[model samples]
Target chain A: EAGVTQFPSHSVIEKGQTVTLRCDPISGHDNLYWYRRVMGKEIKFLLHFVKESKQDESGMPNNRFLAERTGGTYSTLKVQPAELEDSGVYFCASSLTGRHSYEQYFGPGTRLTVT
Target chain B: AQSVTQPDIHITVSEGASLELRCNYSYGATPYLFWYVQSPGQGLQLLLKYFSGDTLVQGIKGFEAEFKRSQSSFNLRKPSVHWSDAAEYFCAVGLAYSGGGADGLTFGKGTHLIIQP
Candidate 1:
């Protein structure tokens, strides 16, 4: 089975511009997740989707960030009016189940650089 | 608040040597502990997890971890280190879901391992 794949391995945009990162999860996976790691910071969760429904989005840092999963097949994270602090690596992950014990497969991650 | 701490920022070990990466977590209840590895420019890969039962848990890529409730620690260990094992390792604590669900994890800053030839 193919693993999770992300688009635009690296993205560079000016501050205040908008950027969207896409993720295609493994086939038949029900759970999709988003996480990010800022420079010199730990990787932190952003949001989760369970079959097109936002299972949990508490990890979202601000209102400018939005994530959507359509048809539960793919997920997109859009950041509008991106700020300089938003520069970091964004990761997408998926799991067969939303249970606590299952392992989550991750993508290569999209490096976003907002200047 | 739940948090994870990886004491060593980086470690250097020789091939065929035993390796240990220390991890400490602070949570109110028993948490799901995990060990993940990430190569350069790659995503985090799950190595092992400890939910319940035996404290020792085996993972892919010849890795294992031991969970100590008393010390509030879950440490990753490998019997023999290989050159390919050089990567960034992170220790995370899964947030307990009240309704039998899963929540986002709290991860440590990560430790970079260097292999000595």
Candidate 2:
């Protein structure tokens, strides 16, 4: 089985520009999650999706950040008017369940650089 | 809020030497602990996990971690370090036990391991 895959391995854009990161979870996986790690910081949770429904989104940094999972297949994270502080590695993970303590498979991550 | 702390920012070990990386966590209940390794240009890979029962759990790549409830710690260890072991190690914690699915993880800043040949 193929692991979680992410698009646009690296993204470079100017401040105020918009960027979208995509993630394709493993086949038959119902739980998808988003996390980001800023330089010199820990990886922080962004949000989670159980199929097409949002299970939890308390980790979203601000209003400019938005996440969506369509058709319960893949997910996208959009940062509108990205800021310099927004530059970091965005990671997507998926698991068979949405409860807790189960291992999550992670992607290579999308490195976003907002200048 | 759940959180993890890795006291060592970086560690250097000679090839074939024993290795240990410290991890401390603060959570309300019995924490679900995990250790993951990130190679250069790669995603995080699970090394091992501690949920219940055994306090010491073995994982892939000859890695192991001991969960100490008294210390509120889950530390990773290896009997002998290999050059390929040079990577960033992250300690994460989760709440509850989900056999079917897992929730979002709270990760530490990570420890960069340096293997000297």
Candidate 3:
């Protein structure tokens, strides 16, 4: 089976511009999560989606960032009016279920650079 | 608040040597612990997890970790190190879904493992 896939492995955009990163989870996975690593920082959770429903979004930094998982299959994280500080790597992962014990499979991640 | 700490920022060991990476966590209740490895420009890969039972848990690539509740530590170990084992290892603590409803993982600043051929 193919693992989780992410598009545009790397992206570069100007400050105040918008960018959308996409992720396609593994087949039959019901739980999807978004995380990112800023420069010199640990990977931090952004949000989680369980079959098209937002389970937890506490880690989202601000309102300029939005994530959507339509049709419960793939997800897209859009950043509007992106700031220079938003440059980092964004990772997407999926799990077979939302249960606490299941392991999550991750994608290669998209590196976004805001100039 | 729940947090994870990886004491060593980096470690270098010769091939065929034993390796240990320390992890510490702070949470009110019994926390679910996990260890993940990431190669350069790659995504994180789950090595192993500790939920309940058997303090010693085996993971992929002959890696293992021991959970010690008394010390609030879960340290990853390997009997023999390989050149391919060079990567960044991260320790994370999973918070239970409760009244506070925190259902995500808190990760530690990873430890970069270096292998000398």
Candidate 4:
């Protein structure tokens, strides 16, 4: 099985610009999650998707950030009016359904630099 | 709320030396614990996890972690350090919510291990 894959390994955008990061999870995995890490900070969860429906979005930092998983497949995270503080690595992960497993397969991550 | 703390920011260990990385968590109830390793420019990889039963857990790469309820700690250990072990290690706590799915993990700042050859 293929591991999670992300697009545009690195991205650079000016402040106030919109940026979108994509993630293609492993086939047949029903759980998808998004996390980000800022400079000198721990990786923090942004949201989770069980198929096309969002299961949990409590960790989302703000309304400017939006995530969608259409047709229960790939996911996209959009950041509008990006700020300098938004520069960090965004990771996507997937896992099998039913089990509360900690073994989440992660992608290479997209490094976003907002200037 | 659940939270994890890794007191050590960085650690340097010579090849063949023993290694230990400390992790502490704060939660009202018992929380699932995990250790993840991340190589340079890579995403986090699961090293091991502790849910119940045995307090000691073994993981890949000859890694192991001991969960101590008394200390509220779950520390990762390796008998011998390898050059490839040089990377960032993160400790996380999984919170169980009343809702269906569990809550996202709460991670520590991470400990960067430097293995000297």
Residue pairs in candidate 4 whose N, alpha carbon or C atoms collide under 3 angstroms:
none
Q: Model 2 lDDT vs. the true structure?
A: 0.91
Instruction: Compute the lDDT of residue A96 as modeled in candidate 4.
Output: 67
DockQ of each: 0.63, 0.68, 0.49, 0.62
**Model 4 stretches astray by more than 4 angstroms:** B97-101
Error of 3 at B50 (Å): 0.8
TM-score of each: 0.96, 0.96, 0.95, 0.96
RMSD of 3: 1.9
* Every model: Cα RMSD to truth: 1.3, 1.7, 1.9, 1.3
Predicted complex 1: CAPRI docking category: medium
Candidate 2 residue lDDT tens string, A6-86: 999999999999999999999998888999999999999999888999988989999999999989999999999999999
For residues B41-93, write the lDDT of model 1, one tens digit per residue: 88889999987999999999899999999999999999999999999999998
How well docked is model 2, in DockQ terms?
0.68
Task: Report the CA-based lDDT of candidate 4 relative to the real structure.
Answer: 0.90
DockQ score, prediction 4: 0.62
Residue-pair clashes, model 2: 2
* Candidate numbers sorted by DockQ from highest down: 2, 1, 4, 3
